[model samples]
Target: MKKILVVDDEFDLLTTWRLVLQLEGYTVVTAANGVQALSLARADPPDLIVTDWMMPKMDGVALCRALAADDRLMRIPVVLSSAAERTPPIEHPLVEFHRKPLSIDSFVEIVARLIGPA
Candidate 1:
């Protein structure tokens, strides 16, 4: 089973994603902020990460930067979601950006494309 880490500040959204991902057959790990997600990734890296852009302790961009900085973690695929119009520079080949108001079908398609079907 593919393991996916999902990070979001909103509790309801986080729980929803976790349940949805889990039901889709991916093992899901969730965090309320990028800080916790980063720590969890370091300890046990997941195949893919789906994160929200704006967060309390650390944002998705910062998490992506930290992942890029780490040699061991740089290759993991990242799916970043944001509601804002502005985008942060995401230079990594494995990183993907998704605007908020994301559809479940589209999100599933993206995940399947990136790391195989759940």
Candidate 2:
């Protein structure tokens, strides 16, 4: 099964995403903030990452940079989401930006494009 790390501070969205992705046959892992996500990724990297840009501890942009600096994690594609204006662009080649309120089907499609089906 493909592993996915979803990082967001909102608890409800986190739970909903986990259930939906799991149903789609992907092994979903979650983090409340980028700090937690970074630690988790270092310990066990995911096939892809879906992160909210305005997280509390560490934001998605920081996570993307940290990942890019790590040779092992740099190539992982990141889907960065935001409800407000788009954040500053990340320099990493694999980063993609998307506006928030993503429909489940759209979200799944985005994931599949990056890492294929679970």
lDDT of 1 by residue, 49-114 (tens): 999999999999999999999888999999999999767797666788889878888888898899
Residue 82 of model 2 has an lDDT of 92
Backbone clash total for model 1 is 0
25-96: candidate 2 lDDT, tens digit per residue: 999999999999999999999999999998898999999999999999999999999997757868678999
* Clashes per candidate (backbone, < 3 Å): 0, 0
Please give each candidate's TM-score.
Answer: 0.96, 0.97
Give the candidate number with the greatest TM-score.
2
lDDT of each: 0.91, 0.93
Which candidate leads in lDDT? 2
Candidate 1 has an lDDT of 0.91
Model 2 quality (TM-score)? 0.97
Clashes of 2: 0
